[model samples]
Target: MKAKVLVTLKTGVLDPQGKAVQHALSSLGFAGVDDVRQGKLIELDLAETDPAKARDSVEAMCRALLANTVIENYSIDLVD
Candidate 1:
Protein backbone atom coordinates (compact mmCIF):
# COMPACT_ATOMS: atom_id res chain seq x y z
CA MET A 1 0.00 0.00 0.00
CA LYS A 2 1.00 3.57 -0.58
CA ALA A 3 -0.08 6.61 1.34
CA LYS A 4 0.20 10.27 0.52
CA VAL A 5 0.02 12.84 3.26
CA LEU A 6 -0.45 16.50 2.62
CA VAL A 7 0.25 18.83 5.51
CA THR A 8 -0.51 22.50 5.35
CA LEU A 9 -0.86 25.46 7.63
CA LYS A 10 -4.36 26.44 8.56
CA THR A 11 -5.91 29.67 7.46
CA GLY A 12 -5.15 32.73 9.61
CA VAL A 13 -1.69 31.46 10.41
CA LEU A 14 1.18 33.68 9.42
CA ASP A 15 3.42 32.10 6.81
CA PRO A 16 6.66 34.03 6.60
CA GLN A 17 8.29 31.57 4.22
CA GLY A 18 5.37 31.77 1.86
CA LYS A 19 5.44 35.55 1.99
CA ALA A 20 9.14 35.56 1.21
CA VAL A 21 8.60 33.29 -1.75
CA GLN A 22 5.85 35.50 -3.05
CA HIS A 23 8.08 38.54 -2.82
CA ALA A 24 10.88 36.75 -4.59
CA LEU A 25 8.56 35.67 -7.38
CA SER A 26 7.31 39.21 -7.86
CA SER A 27 10.86 40.52 -7.91
CA LEU A 28 11.65 37.98 -10.62
CA GLY A 29 8.99 39.67 -12.82
CA PHE A 30 6.31 37.07 -12.21
CA ALA A 31 3.19 39.18 -12.36
CA GLY A 32 -0.21 38.63 -10.80
CA VAL A 33 1.13 36.34 -8.13
CA ASP A 34 -1.25 37.32 -5.42
CA ASP A 35 -0.30 34.90 -2.70
CA VAL A 36 1.88 31.89 -1.99
CA ARG A 37 1.65 29.20 0.61
CA GLN A 38 3.99 26.32 1.31
CA GLY A 39 3.23 22.88 2.61
CA LYS A 40 4.61 19.38 2.94
CA LEU A 41 3.85 16.15 1.16
CA ILE A 42 4.89 12.85 2.64
CA GLU A 43 4.66 9.60 0.73
CA LEU A 44 4.74 6.37 2.63
CA ASP A 45 4.99 2.80 1.41
CA LEU A 46 3.25 0.42 3.74
CA ALA A 47 2.93 -3.29 4.01
CA GLU A 48 -0.77 -3.22 4.82
CA THR A 49 -3.29 -3.50 2.01
CA ASP A 50 -6.58 -2.75 3.73
CA PRO A 51 -7.78 0.76 3.08
CA ALA A 52 -9.36 1.13 6.48
CA LYS A 53 -6.27 -0.03 8.31
CA ALA A 54 -4.02 2.09 6.18
CA ARG A 55 -6.13 5.13 6.87
CA ASP A 56 -6.01 4.48 10.59
CA SER A 57 -2.27 4.07 10.61
CA VAL A 58 -1.75 7.13 8.46
CA GLU A 59 -3.91 9.23 10.70
CA ALA A 60 -1.98 8.01 13.67
CA MET A 61 1.25 8.82 11.98
CA CYS A 62 0.08 12.32 11.27
CA ARG A 63 -0.96 12.90 14.84
CA ALA A 64 2.15 11.35 16.28
CA LEU A 65 4.94 12.81 14.15
CA LEU A 66 4.05 13.57 10.56
CA ALA A 67 2.19 16.78 11.31
CA ASN A 68 2.13 19.46 13.94
CA THR A 69 -1.57 19.74 14.66
CA VAL A 70 -1.18 23.02 16.52
CA ILE A 71 -0.84 25.13 13.38
CA GLU A 72 -1.26 22.58 10.60
CA ASN A 73 -3.88 20.29 9.11
CA TYR A 74 -3.23 17.07 7.28
CA SER A 75 -5.13 14.82 4.88
CA ILE A 76 -4.28 11.27 3.98
CA ASP A 77 -4.83 9.37 0.76
CA LEU A 78 -4.24 5.67 0.22
CA VAL A 79 -3.23 4.26 -3.15
CA ASP A 80 -2.23 0.92 -4.55
Candidate 2:
Protein backbone atom coordinates (compact mmCIF):
# COMPACT_ATOMS: atom_id res chain seq x y z
CA MET A 1 0.00 0.00 0.00
CA LYS A 2 1.03 3.59 -0.62
CA ALA A 3 0.05 6.52 1.52
CA LYS A 4 0.48 10.25 1.51
CA VAL A 5 0.36 12.61 4.47
CA LEU A 6 -0.14 16.34 4.10
CA VAL A 7 0.79 18.43 7.12
CA THR A 8 -0.11 22.09 7.35
CA LEU A 9 -0.34 24.81 9.96
CA LYS A 10 -3.67 25.71 11.49
CA THR A 11 -5.48 28.71 10.02
CA GLY A 12 -4.71 31.08 12.89
CA VAL A 13 -1.03 30.13 13.16
CA LEU A 14 1.62 32.50 11.85
CA ASP A 15 3.74 31.22 8.95
CA PRO A 16 6.98 33.08 8.44
CA GLN A 17 8.17 30.87 5.62
CA GLY A 18 4.92 31.39 3.80
CA LYS A 19 5.28 35.08 4.17
CA ALA A 20 8.76 35.00 2.73
CA VAL A 21 7.56 33.02 -0.22
CA GLN A 22 4.74 35.44 -0.85
CA HIS A 23 7.12 38.37 -0.80
CA ALA A 24 9.50 36.63 -3.15
CA LEU A 25 6.69 35.90 -5.54
CA SER A 26 5.61 39.50 -5.60
CA SER A 27 9.17 40.57 -6.28
CA LEU A 28 9.26 38.15 -9.20
CA GLY A 29 6.11 39.80 -10.62
CA PHE A 30 3.66 36.99 -9.89
CA ALA A 31 0.90 39.37 -9.05
CA GLY A 32 -2.45 38.86 -7.36
CA VAL A 33 -1.25 36.22 -4.91
CA ASP A 34 -2.87 37.58 -1.79
CA ASP A 35 -1.63 34.86 0.54
CA VAL A 36 0.57 31.83 0.76
CA ARG A 37 0.81 28.91 3.16
CA GLN A 38 3.53 26.31 3.21
CA GLY A 39 3.10 22.67 4.06
CA LYS A 40 4.77 19.27 3.75
CA LEU A 41 3.99 16.11 1.88
CA ILE A 42 5.14 12.73 3.21
CA GLU A 43 4.94 9.58 1.12
CA LEU A 44 5.10 6.08 2.60
CA ASP A 45 5.02 2.53 1.37
CA LEU A 46 3.48 -0.05 3.70
CA ALA A 47 3.09 -3.78 3.74
CA GLU A 48 -0.43 -3.58 5.07
CA THR A 49 -3.05 -4.51 2.49
CA ASP A 50 -6.37 -3.60 4.03
CA PRO A 51 -7.46 -0.02 3.29
CA ALA A 52 -9.16 0.42 6.65
CA LYS A 53 -6.16 -0.88 8.55
CA ALA A 54 -3.75 1.21 6.53
CA ARG A 55 -5.70 4.37 7.10
CA ASP A 56 -5.89 3.70 10.83
CA SER A 57 -2.17 3.03 11.03
CA VAL A 58 -1.34 6.16 9.07
CA GLU A 59 -3.65 8.25 11.24
CA ALA A 60 -1.84 6.95 14.29
CA MET A 61 1.47 7.91 12.75
CA CYS A 62 0.19 11.43 12.13
CA ARG A 63 -0.94 11.85 15.72
CA ALA A 64 2.20 10.37 17.20
CA LEU A 65 4.97 11.87 15.06
CA LEU A 66 3.94 13.22 11.67
CA ALA A 67 2.28 16.40 12.93
CA ASN A 68 2.27 18.89 15.78
CA THR A 69 -1.37 18.58 16.63
CA VAL A 70 -1.40 21.74 18.76
CA ILE A 71 -0.53 23.99 15.82
CA GLU A 72 -0.81 21.79 12.76
CA ASN A 73 -3.33 19.51 11.08
CA TYR A 74 -2.85 16.51 8.77
CA SER A 75 -4.79 14.52 6.22
CA ILE A 76 -4.17 11.00 4.95
CA ASP A 77 -4.60 9.60 1.45
CA LEU A 78 -4.21 5.93 0.73
CA VAL A 79 -3.45 4.43 -2.70
CA ASP A 80 -3.35 0.78 -3.46
Candidate 3:
Protein backbone atom coordinates (compact mmCIF):
# COMPACT_ATOMS: atom_id res chain seq x y z
CA MET A 1 0.00 0.00 0.00
CA LYS A 2 1.00 3.58 -0.49
CA ALA A 3 0.08 6.49 1.72
CA LYS A 4 0.27 10.10 0.69
CA VAL A 5 0.19 12.81 3.33
CA LEU A 6 -0.44 16.45 2.68
CA VAL A 7 0.53 18.75 5.52
CA THR A 8 -0.36 22.42 5.60
CA LEU A 9 -0.48 25.26 8.06
CA LYS A 10 -3.75 26.19 9.75
CA THR A 11 -5.61 29.18 8.37
CA GLY A 12 -4.66 31.55 11.19
CA VAL A 13 -1.06 30.40 11.46
CA LEU A 14 1.83 32.58 10.32
CA ASP A 15 3.66 31.29 7.23
CA PRO A 16 6.82 33.22 6.57
CA GLN A 17 8.02 30.84 3.85
CA GLY A 18 4.69 31.06 2.08
CA LYS A 19 4.83 34.83 2.31
CA ALA A 20 8.28 34.85 0.76
CA VAL A 21 7.11 32.67 -2.06
CA GLN A 22 4.11 34.91 -2.66
CA HIS A 23 6.33 37.94 -2.79
CA ALA A 24 8.67 36.24 -5.20
CA LEU A 25 5.80 35.25 -7.42
CA SER A 26 4.60 38.83 -7.57
CA SER A 27 8.07 40.01 -8.34
CA LEU A 28 8.25 37.47 -11.14
CA GLY A 29 5.05 39.02 -12.59
CA PHE A 30 2.58 36.38 -11.53
CA ALA A 31 0.27 39.12 -10.31
CA GLY A 32 -2.89 37.05 -10.68
CA VAL A 33 -1.88 35.14 -7.61
CA ASP A 34 -3.44 36.95 -4.67
CA ASP A 35 -2.25 34.59 -2.00
CA VAL A 36 0.03 31.61 -1.59
CA ARG A 37 0.07 28.89 1.03
CA GLN A 38 2.91 26.40 1.04
CA GLY A 39 2.48 22.80 2.04
CA LYS A 40 4.27 19.44 1.74
CA LEU A 41 3.41 16.07 0.25
CA ILE A 42 4.86 12.92 1.82
CA GLU A 43 4.61 9.51 0.18
CA LEU A 44 5.08 6.32 2.14
CA ASP A 45 5.02 2.66 1.20
CA LEU A 46 3.35 0.38 3.73
CA ALA A 47 2.80 -3.28 4.32
CA GLU A 48 -0.90 -2.75 5.02
CA THR A 49 -3.15 -3.65 2.10
CA ASP A 50 -6.49 -2.18 3.13
CA PRO A 51 -7.10 1.41 2.12
CA ALA A 52 -9.02 2.22 5.30
CA LYS A 53 -6.32 0.74 7.49
CA ALA A 54 -3.60 2.51 5.55
CA ARG A 55 -5.37 5.82 5.88
CA ASP A 56 -5.89 5.34 9.58
CA SER A 57 -2.27 4.40 10.14
CA VAL A 58 -1.00 7.34 8.09
CA GLU A 59 -3.27 9.70 9.99
CA ALA A 60 -1.74 8.54 13.19
CA MET A 61 1.69 9.05 11.72
CA CYS A 62 0.72 12.62 10.89
CA ARG A 63 -0.57 13.25 14.39
CA ALA A 64 2.45 11.72 16.05
CA LEU A 65 5.33 12.97 13.90
CA LEU A 66 4.44 14.15 10.38
CA ALA A 67 2.67 17.27 11.54
CA ASN A 68 2.44 19.66 14.47
CA THR A 69 -1.32 19.45 15.03
CA VAL A 70 -1.47 22.79 16.87
CA ILE A 71 -0.17 24.68 13.85
CA GLU A 72 -0.77 22.32 10.94
CA ASN A 73 -3.45 20.05 9.54
CA TYR A 74 -2.92 16.89 7.49
CA SER A 75 -4.87 14.70 5.11
CA ILE A 76 -4.06 11.16 4.11
CA ASP A 77 -4.63 9.37 0.83
CA LEU A 78 -4.15 5.69 0.29
CA VAL A 79 -3.24 4.26 -3.11
CA ASP A 80 -3.02 0.67 -4.01
Candidate 4:
Protein backbone atom coordinates (compact mmCIF):
# COMPACT_ATOMS: atom_id res chain seq x y z
CA MET A 1 0.00 0.00 0.00
CA LYS A 2 1.01 3.59 -0.57
CA ALA A 3 -0.03 6.59 1.43
CA LYS A 4 0.32 10.28 0.81
CA VAL A 5 0.16 12.75 3.66
CA LEU A 6 -0.31 16.44 3.03
CA VAL A 7 0.50 18.63 6.01
CA THR A 8 -0.46 22.28 5.96
CA LEU A 9 -0.79 25.10 8.43
CA LYS A 10 -4.25 25.59 9.84
CA THR A 11 -6.25 28.56 8.69
CA GLY A 12 -5.73 31.73 10.74
CA VAL A 13 -2.19 30.76 11.61
CA LEU A 14 0.57 33.16 10.64
CA ASP A 15 2.78 31.72 7.92
CA PRO A 16 5.97 33.66 7.56
CA GLN A 17 7.43 31.32 4.97
CA GLY A 18 4.32 31.59 2.88
CA LYS A 19 4.40 35.33 3.16
CA ALA A 20 8.02 35.37 2.05
CA VAL A 21 7.14 33.33 -1.00
CA GLN A 22 4.30 35.69 -1.84
CA HIS A 23 6.61 38.66 -1.52
CA ALA A 24 9.14 37.04 -3.79
CA LEU A 25 6.49 36.29 -6.40
CA SER A 26 5.29 39.88 -6.42
CA SER A 27 8.86 41.11 -6.73
CA LEU A 28 9.26 38.79 -9.71
CA GLY A 29 6.26 40.46 -11.40
CA PHE A 30 3.74 37.69 -10.67
CA ALA A 31 1.15 40.11 -9.39
CA GLY A 32 -1.85 37.92 -10.09
CA VAL A 33 -0.98 35.74 -7.11
CA ASP A 34 -2.68 37.22 -4.11
CA ASP A 35 -1.44 34.69 -1.60
CA VAL A 36 0.98 31.82 -1.25
CA ARG A 37 0.99 28.96 1.25
CA GLN A 38 3.51 26.20 1.63
CA GLY A 39 3.03 22.66 2.82
CA LYS A 40 4.74 19.29 2.84
CA LEU A 41 3.96 16.09 0.99
CA ILE A 42 5.01 12.80 2.57
CA GLU A 43 4.75 9.60 0.59
CA LEU A 44 4.91 6.31 2.43
CA ASP A 45 5.17 2.80 1.10
CA LEU A 46 3.67 0.35 3.53
CA ALA A 47 3.67 -3.39 3.78
CA GLU A 48 0.14 -3.53 5.16
CA THR A 49 -2.29 -4.81 2.56
CA ASP A 50 -5.54 -3.87 4.25
CA PRO A 51 -6.71 -0.42 3.28
CA ALA A 52 -8.33 0.14 6.63
CA LYS A 53 -5.24 -0.88 8.54
CA ALA A 54 -3.00 1.17 6.32
CA ARG A 55 -5.16 4.21 6.82
CA ASP A 56 -5.16 3.68 10.54
CA SER A 57 -1.41 3.42 10.63
CA VAL A 58 -0.99 6.53 8.57
CA GLU A 59 -3.38 8.43 10.76
CA ALA A 60 -1.38 7.48 13.79
CA MET A 61 1.78 8.55 12.03
CA CYS A 62 0.24 11.91 11.30
CA ARG A 63 -0.91 12.47 14.83
CA ALA A 64 2.31 11.27 16.40
CA LEU A 65 4.91 12.82 14.15
CA LEU A 66 3.83 13.78 10.65
CA ALA A 67 1.87 16.88 11.60
CA ASN A 68 1.76 19.44 14.37
CA THR A 69 -1.88 18.91 15.22
CA VAL A 70 -2.12 22.14 17.18
CA ILE A 71 -1.18 24.37 14.25
CA GLU A 72 -1.42 22.09 11.25
CA ASN A 73 -3.97 19.90 9.49
CA TYR A 74 -3.31 16.82 7.47
CA SER A 75 -5.10 14.73 4.86
CA ILE A 76 -4.33 11.24 3.68
CA ASP A 77 -4.62 9.55 0.31
CA LEU A 78 -4.21 5.85 -0.10
CA VAL A 79 -3.21 3.96 -3.26
CA ASP A 80 -2.61 0.42 -4.17
TM-score of each: 0.97, 0.97, 0.92, 0.97
Q: How many residue pairs clash in each candidate?
A: 0, 0, 0, 0
- Candidate 3 Cα errors over 4 Å, as ranges: none
Model 1 C-alpha lDDT per residue in residues 1-80, reported as the tens digit of each score: 99999999999999999999999999999999999999999999999999999999999999999999999999998888
Where does candidate 1 stray beyond 4 Å?
none
Q: Which residue pairs does candidate 1 place in steric collision?
A: none
Clash list (residue pairs), candidate 2: none
Model 2 poorest 10 in a row by lDDT:
71-80
lDDT of 3 by residue, 1-80 (tens): 98888999999999899999999999998888878899999999999898878788888889899999999999887877
Off by over 4 Å in 4: none
Candidate 2 residue runs with Cα over 4 Å from true position: none
- Which model scores highest in lDDT? 2
Q: Could you tell me which residue pairs clash in candidate 4?
A: none
Cα lDDT of all candidates, in order?
A: 0.96, 0.97, 0.90, 0.96
Candidate 3, run of 10 with poorest lDDT: 50-59
